[model samples]
Target: MKFLVDAQLPVRLARFLESAGYDTIHTKDLPHKNATSDTEINSISIRDNRIVITKDSDFLNSFLTIKEPYKLLLITTGNINNLELEAIFAANLQFLSELFVSHSYIEMTRDSIIVHY
Candidate 1:
C-alpha cells in the first residue's frame, strides 16, 4: 500500500511503513516545512493512487473538490499522545493491514473500527 502521512503524524511513521515494504510519504518531506495544504496533499495522493493517513477532518472534505483517493485512514482518537497512537497501531497492525488491503475508508474510533468500501 502507498500512504501520504499528514502533518499531524511524526514523519518517523513513514520510515516505519517503508521498512514494512509500503510506499510512504510524509508532509515534512515536502518543499517547505509548512508548505502543504490538506487539499493539495489529498489531491496528490488521489492523483498518484496513494491512501491518505490523516488525523485531520479537513481531508474528509477533499471529496468536495476531488473525485478520488485510493483510500483514507482517519485516526479519530483526537490529540492522542504519540506513544499511545503508535502502541494502538502496533497492537492492531495485522488487522489494519488486512483492512487497508480491502477498503477505501477506514475510521478507527475509540471503541470500534468502521471500514467504508
Candidate 2:
C-alpha cells in the first residue's frame, strides 16, 4: 500500500510505513512541504494511486461530498502524542492491512479500527 501522510501527522509514521515495505510519503517530503494544499494532495493521491492518511476532517468531507483521493485512513485518536500515535499505527497496521484489501475508508481510534467499504 502507498500512503501520503498529512501535515498534522508525524513524518515518523510515514517512515514506519516505509520501513514496513510500503511506499510512503510524508507532507514534509513534498515540494511545498507541509503547506501543500488539500486539492494538490488529492490530485497527487489520485494520480499516484496513493491512500491519504490524514487527521483532517476536510479530507473526509471532500471524500463524502466529491469522492476524490481514491482512499483514506482517518486517524481519530484525538490529542495523542506522536510516540503514542506511531505506536498505535505500528501495532495496528497488520490488522489494517487486511481491511485495506477491501475497504477504502478507515477510522482508527486509540482502541479500535472501523472500516468503511
lDDT of each: 0.76, 0.91
- lDDT digits (tens) for residues 1-117 of candidate 1: 688888888887777778778888898887755479766786788788888888877776664345445578888987677777767767766787888776778888665688865
lDDT of 2 by residue, 22-113 (tens): 99999999999999999999999999989999989999999988987779999999899988998898899888889888888899999999
| TM-score (C-alpha) between model 1 and the true structure | 0.82
Deviating ranges (above 4 Å) for candidate 2 = none
User: Against the true structure, whose TM-score is highest?
Assistant: 2
Q: At residue 6, what lDDT does model 1 achieve?
A: 84
Give the CA lDDT, 0 to 100, for residue 33 in model 1: 51
